[model samples]
Structures are given as C-alpha cells and as structure tokens.
Target: MKMKNIKLIGIGLVGAILMIGCTDLDEELNDSVNEAAGFSASDLLAGAYSSMRELQHEQDILASYVHSSDELIAPTRGADWDDAGAWRDHHLHSWTNTHPHIDKTWRDLNSRAFNAQLVLCNGDASATEIAEATFLRTLSDFFTLDLFGVVPRRACNEDLLQPPTQQLGRAEAIDVFISEMEAVLNDMPTANGPITATQNAGRMLLAKLYLNKAVYKATGQDGVAQPGPYTFDPVDMTMAINHLNEITGYSLEDDYFSSFTPTNTETSTEIIFVSENELGGATGNIRNRWHMTMHYNQQPSGWNGFVATADLYNLFEDGDVRRSTDIPGLTDAFGYNAGFLVGQQQGPSDKTLTSLIDLEDRPGNPLVFTEEVDIFSSNERNGIRVIKYLPNLELSADADGISFSNDDAPGNDYVFFRYADARLMKAEAILRGGTDTNGESALAIINELRTSRNASMLPAVTESDILDERSRELYWEGWRRNDQIRFNTFLGTWQAKADASPERALLMPIPAEALATNPNLTQNSGY
Candidate 1:
C-alpha cells in the first residue's frame, strides 16, 4: 500500500477553521470558513484538499447518493442499522430538508468549497496552487449544484460578518463552473497518478458538466423541479465528447476489482482521480465499504448495515467480472468474493459463521445472505451484501510481521473518477446525438468494455443498454444516483422501494440551517 507522498498528506486540516462571532463586527464560521487565514500556501492548499477525505465514507454523503437510488438499500435489520429511519427515507424518497444526512452533506461540501476558495483568495498562492484550488472549488460547487440545485458563494474578500449574498442557481453555477475550470485547465500540470489535480481531471469534470447541462438548465420551481423527460442537446453532447477526448493517460483495468483494491494506486490503470487515503492519515473510513454490510460473525466482523438490491444483482450474468467473483486478495483462506456477496459466509479457520444475533427470520443458523429485504423491518439474512473496496488482508490477523485489525484504517484510495466511467460517458454522448471524435461507434465502445469485463458482447446498443452497462461497470461507486438521474430512471419504482419518487425529489431540499444563516437560500418546495 505505497503511494507518492504528495498524494497522501496527513488528513488533518493544516489549522483550524478560525471561529468568529456573528455579531455587528465579528465574521463567524456559520457564514464562511478560513475567513481569517494566515496559513502558508502549501498548508492552505493541503487543507483544501484534505476536506474532501470525509466523502469516502458511507452513512451520510455517499449513503444519500446511493441509498436514494435503486442499486443500494439500508434495511432495518432487527436491532441494527435503523438510524431513526434515515436510511429508509432515502430509499423511499421521503427525505425532508432536515434529514441528517442531507444536512451534513451540504455543510461538508460547503466547507470543502470555502477552504479551496481561501487559497484563491490568498495573495501568496502560486499559479499552480491557484489552478488546483480552482479545480477543487469548482468540483465542490458542481456537487452542490447537482445535489441541491443551488450554490452559496462569498466573493474573494466578502465581509465575514455578513452572510453569503450570492446564490448561484443550477444553470448559472454550470456556466461559472465551465468558465472557471476551462480557464485553469492549461495552468495545471499533468498528474503522475490520479491523486493530484491535473488537466485531464479538469477535462473529466468538463465532460460531466457538459453532459448534464441540459438537466441543470431546466427551469421550474426550486423545490418541485421537474424530473427530466428532457432533451440532450447535440451541441452539449459534442462538447462532452470533446472534453472526454482531451483526457489522456488512463486506460481500463483488465482485472475489474483491481481498480478498487487496497493497493489500487500501484495496480490499477483505470483511476483518473481519487481521494488519496493513507493507512494512518486521511479522515475517510474506506473500510466501511465492506464493514457496512458484512455480518457480525464474518471474517472481519461488521456493523451489517446495508446491501445491494436483488434487482441490481439480477442485472448481471454469471461470467461477468463486475458480478461477484472470488477475488485473490479479498477471497482470503475463509473465501469471500469482491462484488455482491450471497449464500453462507466463512470466517476464521474456514468456519461458517453463524448468526450470533437472534435475527427474526434466521436465529442461531448460518449467516446466509438472502435476496429478500424490506426497508421497514428485516432480518440479518434478508439482503445480499456487497464488498467493492476490499481491505489489504496482508495486515489482517492471519499475516505475520505487519499488524492490522478492523479498527485500523485501510489504505484504499476512494475512487472519484476512473477511465471506465469516462469511456462510458463518451459512449453515452455518442448515443445522445454526438459523433465520436475517433470514429468509435457506440456499439463498438459498449462491446469493447464488455469484452474487458468478461461479459458477453451485445449485437447493438441503445440508451437502455448504456444505462445498464453503467450499472454493471460503476456499481457501488457512489455514482448510481447520478447515472440513474441522467438516464431518467431515478424516480422509477424498483426493488425494496415500491413507489415512484416525486418530481420534488429531484432536488434535495435546502437545509433549514442554511436558510437561517444565509438569506440567499430558498428551501426546495416539498420540504
């Protein structure tokens, strides 16, 4: 689990986000962060980047993105995973503005934006620092726009005592993001690995922005925004393709799970941008990818919180690499696989771990993961678990010399962007009415990816095929919601979530705390 030191800084925020009173004179933290910064350019830049580390964890931001979609669910398993119905509301699309997860995500993302902007606002920042900071700020804004349909902004030296007055609506935010990112693209250096900000990473963001422009451009009520049955402009699609074409120096990994392993930075060719994690650094809990779903009696005992839906499991055939398969590192002596986990699980010394907790349906029996799951109430055996990011078992109890445990941090760099997703976006652009720059047909690109994944080739491709392919390739990567939203299938009923989501669900409600602090924020209507 080695990485370039530049990519893995101590996860600590170089210094505290200076606190101030929100009085007639003092500028408080509630309105802005890094308001009274006197830190070095390096310290501020590193701090800016460090704020993103928390994104890799589930139960909040990533959970909201995934559990709201059809691919994942956090069913109430008897006494565990019932967080006051927070997980269930996400799956059922009944979340209010005050939803803890939604509120936390908004604050976390805003902090990221503020820290990056402080670097830009600082007089000492070099050109390279500015470019990287610009990318970080835009990335934070893009997420805010996508999730909440608005982004609050304080100018370069806005008064800290006053709340943020500028609120960029979705469409306007899109315009500013494109302009800012494009302006700095050439200033950033090419990255040695996916960890550092680079021109290619900037291009990837541009590609995403262009592809989703039409959706953001949709004008309607702030809260009850219309879910897309919208148009994909050929111009925007072509722009998306052009930006994708500019992204270089990455390729699809032949071994699909290698892209997410603990040593992925050394082994994988697919990663384009990642939140670089360190064994004893970075704030993100990457181990939760496995720990969130696995049973208490499994090899590395877990909280048994969430699972992949049966509908998503049914999408794949037996031979696909993306489908659950016995992984070399993860499938240790006890035998666990990389993707969707089902059937009886094994623990230490090849023991079949039994359900220690008295689950309603299967008490004192083998810890078997059945396909059936209900959000309101379920047993430990009700849902098929997933393990996308596998831990480095060399540090496990079995290994000699090196020491590790479930409590120790895992050095799995959480994926933010990968070449496979970019390639898929290119195919999506072509399907949406753009001609491929390299004369690559949509079917050819689709089939080519399938061949790499060991899945059967399709005779042709359609929008549905593209969406399904996205599901298979990018499952459990915190992108299912964005992909589902882009494909216009997000609101549709599926699996444990029986009812179709409302149009108002398209935009998560602006948190009440934000409204109280900033006069610019308008709550999305349904809340």
Candidate 2:
C-alpha cells in the first residue's frame, strides 16, 4: 500500500471534510472544497484534537509498565494480558516486528501535523485558530521525537508528497525537532493581533521543548539502552531554561484538583495548554476508562477498562495532599459521592463472591488501605483506579455528550507544560550536568516540587530522584520510556517487569512499513 500523507490536505479542505459549513473558499475557485465549505475552523481544529486523543490512548497503555508487575495484572482478566494487555505485549516483553500501534500512532501524529500545516499553509485561519493549530502540531512532533528519537521532520504538505528517503536516526531527528519547535514557538501568533487573549495564555508547546532538550540533544546509535554518541549540551539547557521561564501569566493552582475539572478549564492557572472541548461536542469521552474505574455506579459510571498502577500509588509521601486526589479511602469532593473505599476483588475468579465488595463494587471506589492489590496476576485486586482526568462534575463526566462540551467541559486545560514540570526538568539537568552559577542545584529544584506538596521525606536530588519525580508527576502524560532509556533503566529490571528478554526492544524496531520502504532504515539495536 502506498503511504498516504492525508494531512497534506489544507485547513479549508480538511475543515470542509469535518464540519459542514466552515469553508472560506469560493466554490468556483476551489470546487474541491465546495462540498465541505460549510465546516467551521473550530470543527476542523476539533478533528485535529481527535488525533491527539488517539495518541494519548496509545501512550497511556505503555505507561502502565510502572505497576504492571506480577503484583498488578495477574488477577484482573489481564491474564490474557500477554495477548490482551498492552504492557505484557508491546512494553514488557518487547514483541518486536508485530506490534502495530507504533505505526498507527506515527500515522496519526503525521496526519495531525499535516492538518496543522495545511491551516498554516492555506486558507485565512484566524490568529487564535492558527496559534492553537501550531501548538497541536508542535506537540505532535515533540511526542514523535520522544517515541522514535529521530523521525522525518516534515512541516510542509509538499514535503510528504516526495518519495521517502531513509528514516533519520535519533540525533538527526532531535535536531530537526528542535529547529522546528524553535520556528513554531517564534511563529506562535498571539491570541489576537496585538492583544493576547487570557484564555489562550497557557499553551505548553514551548515549555515541553525546553523540558526535553537534554534527551533530544543527547544522541545515541545503539538501541539496547547504553549511553550513545550524543553529548549533553549546557547551552541547550540554558536555552530550555530561558524558554521555560518566558511563558507568562500562568501559575499553579493551590488546589491541585482544580486543574482538572471541566469548570476549572475556564479559571485554572495551572493549565499551560488545553484542547478546548465544547459541551456536547465530539471526542469528549477520551477519558472514560479512567473515570469508569472510579465512578461506574454513580449513574452509568461509564466503566469499560483501564486502571492505575501500584508503583505510582507508592510514590505518594505520608502527608502529601495529592494522594487524596485519588487514594483508596477518601470521601466525595464537597457533597458529591467520590473517594476511596475498600473490599474489592483484584482479579477475575471462578469462585462465587459472598460479598458485594467484590470487583464490581470496587469500580469507582477508592482505597482504604495503603497497599494496592495485583489483580491481573494473582487474581487478586492489587491496584488503585485512576481518577486524574475525569471531570469533577457529573455533567462534565457524563458520557451522553462529547468530552469537552463545546469547550464547555469546565476549563481544566490539559497541562502540557507548567512551572512544576519546568522546575523538575531544571533539577534533572543539574543532576545530569547543570551548574550552580545561579546558586541552584538539581536538589534545590526537586525540593521545590516536594516542598510544595508538603513532602517531608525527600530523596537525595540525583538522576534517579529526578527520573522518579518525572514518573510521579508526568506518568500517563507520556515520557516513561524515554526516561527509562536516557537514565539507562529500560534494559534493567524493575518491579514485576524487566527487560530480560533476548532481543533489543530499544527503538521500536523501525516501524515495519518504514523498513519495507527504506533500506537505510535498520532495526533499532535489540530487535
């Protein structure tokens, strides 16, 4: 099959496809878009955001490696996990030369990027719409780099039409992403012509670029998880720090939970970038899996699948308030019925249940104990249900309509980059190779996140701690595998998971199609 660069279609065209009345082009001059000329720019943007949701779903499956050990998946029907679960297959055992999501994700990201490029390259996209679109594209490339290390950097739709060459290696792709990001951020049009809109102030594209510089700049050829030829550049660190510090008019919400509810999107200060979800709009159910695990009984609970890992739960400190955010036993927020409860099955069983407090009851329930049951493996319930992205209010959580109610799903803007993440990256940089010329060390920066959460026992600010904090704060948001590789942990063993297999699982064995298309594209080290 020929690789179709579908994203090359311009905004006017793509918009026309998704929305019925959004086209600005005249039918005579552009008869191709005449059918879709009625589509709105916002609707076109919504279609682009759908791709974002797809990418997040793929990443979330991989992030489960944190607690997917024997302690977690054994009991839950995740038994077929090897064939059924994402962890046992794609991540844990490294089933190279077969997994298809890797390619699908790239294809989705490419499509999203192409759509954004279309908007920028064609039609009269308003400044706000263009800014949002570019932010989305930058995000797509940023994640693409994170996953593949080095990917083909194509900004123009025209670039995709050309016959492909060898897929670029990790280092080359890093440079490309950096250059593209620099261009994207600089070209980020204001929310308005002269005056920036307050609603658009918190976009996270720039901050994420700065946060991942060290990983991006560090080059490596081998895929089995050893330090590569890439050298860490302090100048890159400085530039990253500068970009991070430059984002203005955003602050952390004192109540961490405030940053996630549908209503919070409008007033939350922590949101750096949000994919606006209008009430009753499309693509609103992206977070159903997480919410269903905790709210299935409260009216439909919307339960289908997905849960949290014990490793992440263990990351919470004694007095840390964040734990209550989704712990085993807490109560409703205000008067609502939300919080942890105990007495739930960890996995499926042939035996009959004497109590209602089985797995069924456990859904939408919280923990009363400190321990998480390993349901998938032991047939015992051993993990906490995730509640992070579920909108706090019932209407916001309702499955009846699209995820974001016409951008009305409260204003819990998705935090692509925020001060906490920035500070953590700075800390990691220091631990890796940063200096204290400004009187700050990796330890100091790490403590900021710890202290803010009122964490009493802090780990020594080292490379390990930095990586650990990243897992704790940025888990499902996507960054686990990259951190594992850069810190040299991918090949090592951890929890119920390990890299003891025979082949290299390093750089997702160059996507199957790419290998068939380009001879220069060799498989990553271990595959």
Candidate 3:
C-alpha cells in the first residue's frame, strides 16, 4: 500500500455484521461484516479504521466516559436533552446494566475487535495489514477490558459452528494484549504518519496499557473490582517509560489548539495517531464536537447539549493557550473563540448575529453561556461550552441551513494519541516510581509542556498536580474517566454526581444484554 501521509483514506468496504454483543447467537462471532463469500482484507481493515470515528464524537462510548467523569456533562436543559434520562444516569453513576449507552458502547467496541480480526481471517492480508489489524484488535480489546472486564477471545481457525468458551479476564486479557501488541509493534509501518497504524502509534498504545497494568491486575477477569490506590509497580512504570522513549521525532505544538485544528494532520507536530477526515465532506464526525455544544443562535448553530463542568474550566491559569485561542480565519469570521467558551457567544457575518428567542426563561437576550448549570433543569445557555475540534469555516455554508450543517465541514482529523500525552504519561510513570527516561524530574518534564502552552511554571508537582495538568491539557479528548480512575479520584464528588460514588462505579457493569448473550461474561462488583 502506498504510504498515506495525512489523508484519512477511506477503504470502500462491504461493512460487516455488528457482532451484537460479546457473543454470537450463531457460530460466527462478530459475524461476517461482509456476508459475501469473497472479500479483500483491505476492505475489512478500512471498516475497522472507519468505525473508530465513534471514539471521536462525544456520544455513546465517549459520552459514557465523559458524562461519568468530572470534566463534562450532558445536563437536561429543561426538555431538550432529557432523553431516557441517560445523561442524568451517567452523571450520578446510577446506571444499570441495561442502560442504553452501555449496551450500545459495548457492541460498538466489540464490533471493532471483530472487524479487525476479520482482516486477519482473510487469507490475503499483507504483513502491514496484519500488523494494523493486530493493533486495532488489541486496541478494541484493551478498551473492552478497561471499560468492561473480560473480552471475547477465539483461536485462529476456531470452529465457527460451536459456542466458543474463551473469554479472558482483566489480568489475563491485559497480559494477552500486551504480548500481542508488542509482538506486532516492530512490524508496523514507520512512514504512514499518525493517520494509520505506525510504530510510534503502537508504542503509544503499549505505553497506555502498561501505565494502567496495575489497575488491570487489580480488576480481575471474573470482574468484581473497585477504584484504587493500586500499586503501580516500578516494572510496569518502567515499561511504560521505555515504550514512550521508543516513540521518536514528535514534539508538542507551540499553539496548544494547533494539535486539534483542521490542518492538524499536516501542521501539528504532536499528533501520534489521528483519523483521516474528509477534505470536503462531513462523513467524519469531528464536527460533532462543535455542534454538540454551541447554542442554536451561535455561529454554525449547535445542539446545545454536552457542557463542561466548571471544575475542569477552573484548572487552567491565565495565559494558558490550551484554555482558549482564536483560530485566525475561523474565529474572527464566526465570532466564537476555539477553546473553553464562556459568557456571550457570537454569530456569523450575516444580516445580524442571531439572538436568543423562544427560550421562555431568557428571551431576547444574547446567546450567553452561564458558568452555572443544572442537571435536571437549566436555561438553554447553561455551563461553559468547549470547542477542541474547531469547525472548518472555509466550507461553504448552506444558504438556507444554520450556517453549516454536517455537509459544510469535517476536515479535522480526530486525534487519538499525541506526543504531549506521551510526555505526561512518562512524567506520571516516574512519579509512580519509574526511573526518569527524559533525564528530567517529573516537575521539569510537565513544566516543559506547560511553558510551551504559555502557562506559568508550576512551583512543584504532586499526584494531584499531575491529574489537574492532564485535565487542563487533554480535556474533552475522551480520556478523563481513565485518568480519574488511575488517580483514585474517579469517585470524588464534583459539580454533578454528588454523594460518595461507589467503587464499583469505577467499572461500568457488563451490559445486561451482553450478560444474557454470553454467560462467560460476569458482572463487576456492586452492580
């Protein structure tokens, strides 16, 4: 395959069977995404990559992670977002096994695993294809274990007719994934850049697994587990540092949001893994970030759902580029700055920037986002909105539609892993007892990124400082729940979910549908 520099290349695929849950009613688990007899491995591989857009949009899987964490919320604005009381359940950690998002997320994640393995199953997969497939499968399996406990496992050439009996538990699954990812890391392409599975991306993925190995070890495969002060062994920490060390030739972006803009694939130095979005179409869902938060009256009007909690917004100090910035053409043209959006929002250069109306609570007012928000009820403009994945204002707006809809833009590649995160992970690994691979103290290493973002130097560093720093730099990128769990602060009360959070809440329960479909899957503790 020709090296794809930055385009999120789309492989025309005969998409596969969704693999409803971890189990299959018939023989083929994650049944043939392509029902036809003959299919190319490349097509299956593209399906695997394309499906990863689910991770980009803050919905379903990412929604569960964000709504559960302290960083973001999906508060019911009167009657607007109160669907199934889903967001409320996630915020309160009062979700049941049958929660809709939980079931859907589980299915979506396993589907990725099944699709990747599908590529491997196809006899024609090249070495590069096999390497990428292996990485995707492990990535899917990794999240499955992290969010749930056990992941479905099947041997190569295993009977498609029999009910399979191998489901690896947390520790066992983690070990298997680590071994498998390491097994293929070196074979991954080095020249594909961050848009595909490259050696550097493999390294970053392995580092993540290793950093959380202690937690995986604590959360056994049979599934009952809680949040922890889990012993981050020096060996695991060292392995994380070592893998991160292998990821070379990348650095933090001078402008923090540069890592997230439309040209990120070509411009950002920090990206380690990203999805290729359309240059002209909205097939890519990166546009969801902006539309999900900004109010209807704001330029490129949004759904006015998903808002950031103040706790996360308060973490940044003055002059931190990560906090907010104005994208030259986009921000000036559309009236909203690109980071933590608070106070009054603005409209595009139309006859007049739109105004608030029909919102009974505050009609005829500007589209102002209030710092305060309510979960059960709030005016339309409540809580600060975020715009990490900036809109592509260059796309021609619909003459009749609200500035731009899905068709207007989606060129921004969805960022997965990045260099800044790797640096932070190494610093955290050292703080947890590993030797400093960067030859700098954890404080100095963190300060390097801090100074790059124009944030003031920290006088010192602590575990709390690390957690806050991660929040400031990586907010709304969909890793908060993982960070909070690792730091043992997941259960801490924040703006939304008050009262003591149950430790079992650290790991969501296996979807009831999954438990019913696959007996091998066991529920986590306290569910």
Error of 1 at 332 (Å): 4.3
Q: After best superposition, candidate 1 residue 181: deviation in angstroms?
A: 0.6
- Compute the lDDT of residue 213 as modeled in candidate 1: 88
Q: Please provide TM-scores, in order, for all candidate models, with all chains considered together.
A: 0.91, 0.71, 0.91
Candidate 1 displacement at residue 321 in angstroms: 1.0
Alpha-carbon runs more than 4 Å astray in model 1 = 1-36, 221-224, 350-362, 395-407
Model 1 has a clash total of 1
**Candidate 2 wrongly placed segments (more than 4 Å):** 1-51, 58-87, 123-135, 153-166, 190-207, 210-231, 295-305, 326-330, 333-380, 395-413, 435-441, 457-460, 498-503, 513-522
Candidate 2, residues 1-527, lDDT tens digits: the string is: 11111222354333222221122334432544433234456555554654444444433333323322221222233332333554455435555555665655555555556555555554667766676566666666666556655444333332222323435455565565556555545446444311121223322345455445555555444423334323556665666555555656656566665555555456566555544443444333345434435433322233423345466667767666555544221122211222222243232122121112323434344423224443345322344555555453433355343232333222233444455666676676565564535657677667777676667646566677887787766655545665665666655554445445442554455566655544444566656
Candidate 3 residue-wise lDDT at 262: 72
Give lDDT tens digits, candidate 3, residues 190-260.
98787799999999999999999988888643566656888999998999999999899998888788887
Model 1 residue 446 CA deviation (Å) reads 0.7
